[model samples]
Target: MSDKVFNKKIFAYIVAVVLSVFCFLPCLCLVEAEEQPSEAPTVYAADVSVTQGSGTYIYVYAKNFADVSGLDLFVRYDTSAFTLGRATKGSFISSALCDVNAETAGEIRLSYVSVDGVSGDGLILTVLLYSESEAEIKDYKVDIIVGDCYDSGLNSVAVSASGCKITVKEKQQITETVTFYSRYEDVTKRKGDEVALSFYTYNSHGFASADFEINFDDEMLALKSVSLGESLKNTDSATFSVNDKTDGYVKISYAALSAAPSYVTVLEISFTVIGDKDGQTQIEFISSALYNSDLTAYNGSKSIVTVNTEEIPSVIVYPKISLKAHSVTYSEVELDIFAEKDTLLAAGDFFVEFNAEEYECVDIVKIFDGSMIVGNTAFKAGMARLSFIYEDGISGDTAIARLRFKVLAPCETKSEFSISGSKITDKDFNEQIVEYVGTTIVVPHDFSNEFTTDEQPTCDTSGSKSHHCSRCAAVKDVTEIDALGHEYIHHEAKAPTCVEIGWKAYDTCSRCNYTTYEEIKAKGHTKAVAVEENRIEATCLEKGQYDSVVYCSVCNEELSREKKIIEALGHDYIHHKAKAPTCVEIGWEAYDTCSRCDYTTYKEISEKGHTKAAAVEENKIEATCLEDGHYDSVIYCSVCNEELSREEKTIEALGHEYGEWIVDLEPTVSAEGREYRKCLRCEHREERSVEKLKNDDEELSGCFGTLDLTSIVMIVAIMLICGVFVKVKSRKSNR
Candidate 1:
């Protein structure tokens, strides 16, 4: 072969070897030119969620050839009903677009010049990408229900890049439905117990509500709760409660499972109750569907129910002891009984009997059993197992049940009075007493034939003028004029003719006049009515004996000051009813009454001060002032700049002299207690400006300015590692 032919053949072989090496390099793999794209960029906002007062930024990134420049940002958010804006840089400037929920809507855009060194973006050709979707909702805490008509998979979000995340930024709230919880109180309740039941019908928008009757059957035996929720999302729960008066069943039927406000979708929820004797004493829950379209509800939409109950029993009592009163009429006896369960219950009755161990006498007396409401009967006298029976309102089924109570003897009280007599000459006493003015005599007994005595009597016997001091000093036989013509003294008063000078017949008295109790007894008068100590001559004539009025010297009218009695005058007793109201009444039939007391009342002396005592003479009051200031606090009489003088002087006023001001007392403590009147005195204390205190504020304990060089270096290191990892992952994914 010739030299030229050999050279051409070798070159062709070399070309083939070079192509094989290039293919093995991996970085120079050939790609189709048709796949290279170049068009004006766009930013598509998938969707988003943000709360008012919160801030977050979204990025729309695009890659281009080395000569290509930046792509600006813009947005349209009025559900596409918004206008677009010219390009601007991709950056935040305040709580603006970055704060997705910044209260400004329509569209959001990130724009910039092809900003290589802030200059290249002027070229204007663009490239674009998209951010997640946008949702601007107020109150961040709103319970939300988002119905997506465009797409379906929010239940589990997927991002374009790893580590990029999406969250339910704001909660959706249901305005149409108001939910609540229910609970059972009985220990017999179990985890799946249908302890109560009721029914409710809801409207299409979840508003109008009406409770109906519960219809029970065999299938839904353990009905936890009737609820509504989304099909895929595992949302929170709704609650329910029971007051026990529930029927054996319930029915829940609504126009639809969920309501419509912005969009319509099905709502779902599950109910869970853990009891089996484990439960909550009270319930806390969100409200359920109640009001109708106009926010109105049915009559019984909200109601309370109560359960009927049975009671336990009382078996036996001990302390086998007895007590005979000092008078055998009253005393106390104690007895014991056994019971189970720490329960509180209603009022009840017991029947008990007592017969003396040896002397079984049937005398009426009261019996007590430590129960204040428990009544005691009157006991004549006796012993022998003061047996009584009682019932308890709290019973048990799975346990042995018993309760305890005690019995006690009771007593009745009676007030006693002793009769007595008094003596003095009414006219004679008046004549002999100037110091005795305004004072009168009081005794415990009454005397008759008091006006018959013409002479003073002694304790011993005297003639008709001289006397046997018993009923009267002396008495006349007015019976001589009677049809029987017998000599017996008559009970009559003497009428004075012309009111001639003093006749010496004076009888009933303890301190002012004289009277024998025997004579008072004969006239059939009680001691209380006849004798009172302070006799006011004015009103005494009306009451006969003065107990309440004071002697009035001017008008001669009775000066009636209030009288002291156990109860108020005209209001010492009251009457009342005994039975409690039942379901038959509209809530309350037993209001407060005092008919049995037989009177209305006034505040007792203890309750109202100054009820009787008169005011004393007033004194002239004075004052002194002093300064009270602290080291740290600043104070000023903002109105009057006048410096106050601090001194203390005792001024007598309102009938009394208040004490002086003591400087030694702690001013801080004193200032807290006394409300100082800002008068001509305290005007000094100056106040400092708040602006001056601002300088004392603390500075943030952090490094400011761009991140430290060290941090930047670390970030760069992390980015490098992540980029390598991503590249490897990409290769694997492609493979």
Candidate 2:
């Protein structure tokens, strides 16, 4: 073979071995890489926005997470703009236990955990933010801070912080105005009289149309008609509508072709005074609306007109007198003389007459605003007269005089002051006609007969009372008051017991034979006693009992006798007297007995006492380097056939007994030294070292040393090749 070919083959084998080793190195490195720990997850905040009075939320996001257990998220925001509400867990942590503290004004914190770990990306928690009413219309900032965050492994999670911006907007607003009024100050009319009221309005902006609703006391006045006022009626194209279908209220609407004047009468309403009793009622404009030409709203004002019934006299011209009548028992009656109108009254004379048997005129005087009067009053029997003259005539309506009368006795009669007979003249000395309305006066007479009693009648007794005249000291009548029956109070009966007697309780009236009670009976004996002394003692192996008796505590009688068994205690053996078996001697028998019954028992004991004789070897053998030696030994009991001890003994090892060392293999120049020896009996061999000739010639040595196995084989193959080559050459020459 060619040398080049052989070298190529060797190079190929080297490359293969190097490649194989290189391949294994990468696999080992990969295993090491796989064993390295993973990085922790990150948590962060997300931005959000909300309007004033609107609700929104912010998110706490977790990224690159794995097996997360719990985390505390702390976030801060502008307290002036935002309010924290409920916090909700994200899907990643939805099933975990959670706690939220958003109650603090601007800060919110949440924590969540799960027994089963949470992992992956997504939100960890979401918190709600509500814009408060006082929140300003501007931007708000929410910032996040790192808190306690952990994974299922209890390792803290790394987190990055970010802030969110919230925008707030203002709310909307609205404003409006309308009004109504009456043309008259107040109207006065008699019952069954009709009156009219005109409603007007004043608006800054001229109005094209107007609508109004007016309400009045339905019991006092009934709406008769409603019509457009003259101001609105002049508009030829104007329209008017009225709704009087509902009692107590009239709704009217007026529209013009163009905007009406700023101040104009919008409606005329007529009503009839229907009720009989005299009263004043309000004609109120409850609601009103004025519209511009384009139908846009315009502001206005509202007003009310008071309507009074004429049954109440007017304070203008007529003079009126009022006398107040009281109970017949009243000591005196007063007459208040007043004028319905303000007038110049120079002089006036008044006279009042009452029943002579019931009352008498006691006094006459002028009351309030009487400084202008110089009067002399006279009263006698049942007639009273008063006259006055004013230095400067009276100008306004006022009380002229006050007359008082004394009650003479108890009587029912009518009395009055007559202005027809009296005289009233003005400063011009002209007579003034006065309208005087009179009232009946009654004076009650004192009664001698009166009912008197000390105590009121009750359900259980009759009470007596007397009727007599206290003033006349006359007994007009005497009678008795009926009695009321007694009301008995009772208690439920109690049941009888072994020692206590039972009874029922009740009450009885003192004035009447109304009695209530309950029966009581003697109680029986309650028995109790100590344990009986007739009980038999229990044996260790058997159970026994005796009758126990109980006696009554109150009667000293036997109540019950019952059997109570005593439990048996097992036998007790004495440990100190126990006999143990020995190697040669026989032990005494063991026995047990009950402590209470004295019953005995016995048990067989094995013999254990024994003494051992000295050991004697029976079989013995010699030992060699390769084989073990042995001997048998035993110790016998001195008093029995039992062997106390036995053993198989070893005679100690006879290690290799080698002869003198001799050279086993002669060392070559490149080889190490070697020598050996053998055991005489076992033929076991041992070796020793011998020195080798050192190699000084470099040309003679192979790669490792002088001709190692591989080099030597290669050299022998070369020699064979050289011989084959010579043979081939010879063969060729012969050819």
Candidate 3:
């Protein structure tokens, strides 16, 4: 072909392509520019009422949510009337990457992002608040402020935010009886011994103001000093005045900025024994006035303290039972019991009590190796008993036994062990004075609520995660995740032809290197259509011989060769003109042939097979969750440039692996619950209904007294908030 003609054809092709593109692009643009009808997302909170001294959860919901991928939301509420508790991610954002901050007073900030945007309506956040008992009965607002939100394209999404009102109702008042009393029993002290007595006040309603006047026998007991106790821990203003001029009275005026403890030590008074002879005197609270935060007077009692003066004993020896920690761990604890006596030679019996709910008794080994020896060691429920006798005597601090206990509640907890029903006898079998002291063991923090992934699993390597205590941040549980084996992709092999070398089929890892193969073998030449090479015709005049070669059609390689003889004949020559070569076929110069004889050779015209081919995709199908799909890579033929499709491949489907159930709606006394469990692989949800609420009056155990249906339901709602949702890392795949 002429260069000019080729240039013209190429120019025409360019113009056609440009025109086609111009014609089609505008229609696509028009379709893309057409907007879909949708409303802006609305974020709102729910109106709720809570009883005083109780807690309730506030939910932030989203409506008309469309194509929303991420949000940075803020909520504000009054902190004066309520204290914040746990702030958690709701079901709508359960699988989304989220961060929650409730550390700031009166404000909560939540940030969430999803790879595939969420739509429709659901809960986004849940916050807990405890209403102060002393807070005024009024309404409060929880507001959703303006925040940043975005769509899957990272374009800003306009969000309409609204807030809700919370009403705090007055709790039903239970009459609380407050008593001011001296808890001291009648005490005997030697002359000149200082008499110190403590007075406590018990007010279930919790007082903020109090005034007390105490009168002692001033003639026999001289007033020394007065000190405030734990009840005044919150006292913003307090005035204590001694009325020595009035002979026997002391005035204590107390006021607190906050409600004081319900049960606490109020005051301690010390007096000097001034009576010349042996006698008894009374230190009594003559009058008292106490008011709660509401200024309601607390019922009071006038209790007296009696001090008896007695001569010191000639031989004062006090038998003592003491406790010392022997060993302590996260799972077990041991305490050593000891006996101390000033006078030697004695037999004794001891009883110990512990909180059964916090610990379990494992073993008690007697440590006292003495004459006669110990007897009757027994334990039950919350108590342990041990008795021992002496043939001669044992005294002066001797270890009695080692008490071993298994920790039941391992989280940071306190267990108290008390000694009771203990008695010691002298060698003569005479009862002796004794004092028993109890001890408390506080366990270190252990695993409870939250878990963190320490290492992520790979295709070949395992991972580890640990559960930590919610309160103390101590690791209590450690777990290992199994390794995921290699995901393999099957690679089809290219078969060898008569002349071409071929590759052997092998599998390769999509995740990790599990198996490998690179071996290839040569095929024993399978014959294709054979082509004759270097052939000559027989002539008439002379005997003609030619070498005949057979070439492989598949790879154009010489396969076989043979020499053949032909009969010669006289030449009858004919002349042919030469032809020029063109792109479509080959041409040769002029040649001659004989008429009626095979004498002259004639030039032949030939065409060649195609040398290059570009691969094209055909019959493509995308893989789905339930079925496998495949596509083919079709390459062109060398000779005709027609498609010779090869290398068909398949994509495996992903099966569903579901996670734990997520509670969307909690069961109530009046309504059934709805929940859904999602597949971990694809985020597909399977929803189901839960059983209706049962009579759970027993579960309603708390400090809150008799409550109405609304308050009761609020309590139940908080209790039913289970920790079943597994917090996962950010997912990158789109659904």
Query: Candidate 1 regions off by >4 Å?
Result: 1-14, 18-188, 195-735
lDDT for each of the candidates? 0.29, 0.67, 0.72
Q: Where does the lowest 10-residue lDDT sum fall in candidate 2?
A: 370-379
Candidate 2 per-residue lDDT, tens place, 259-368, comes to 76668777788888887666677877744356777877654445778877757454564655545442235466776666555445667766666667666666566665
- After superposing candidate 2 on the true structure, give the runs of residues whose Cα lies further than 4 Å from its correct spot: 1-318, 326-331, 342-346, 354-358, 370-382, 389-398, 410-423, 426-430, 445-451, 454-482, 492-501, 505-507, 522-735
Q: How accurate is candidate 1 locally (lDDT)?
A: 0.29
- After superposition, the stretches of candidate 3 with alpha carbons farther than 4 Å from their true spots are 1-37, 175-735
Residue lDDT tens for model 3, 1-735: 654675566556556655655566666556646754457679998799997766677888989998899999999888889898557677787778989898889999999999999899988887778788787898998888858899999999999999999999987664555777676646677657788888876654677776666666555777788866754754565444444433456667777756777678888878887765577777767433567778876545567777888654467546667788988877888888776745353677777788888887777786767644343334677777766676566656777678788888756687788886545777888776776788989986655566688898888799988987654657746989777667788888877766456777888888766555665555555445544445666556567676777665565577787777778666677898887654357887788877866656667677554554788778999876677889998798665676656889888986777899999999887689999998876678899998877656745553355554445444543343221111111111221
* Candidates 1 and 2, the one with greater lDDT: 2
Q: Using TM-score as the measure, what is the rank order of every candidate, best first?
A: 2, 3, 1
Pick by lDDT: 2 or 3, better one: 3
Q: On residues 1-735, what C-alpha lDDT tens digit does candidate 1 reach at each position? A: 654665465555555544644454343223323444554322222233433212232333332223222322333333221122212223322112221221234444343222232211222211111222244432122111111111122132111211112233442233344332233344433344334422122433344232222222112223355443232122122222333122223334333223222221222222223323332322212222344546454222232222222222345432111121222221222222221222211122222233333222232222333322323333223222122222332232111111111212111222111111112112123211111101111111122434343444343333233223332333334222112222233334432222122232334533333332221111221122122445543221122233554533322334344433332223223443344333222222323434434233322111111122222222323333443322222222333322223333344322222343333322341143222222234332322222112221232323344454445445655565566556656755776
The local lDDT score (0 to 100) that residue 17 gets in candidate 2 is 52
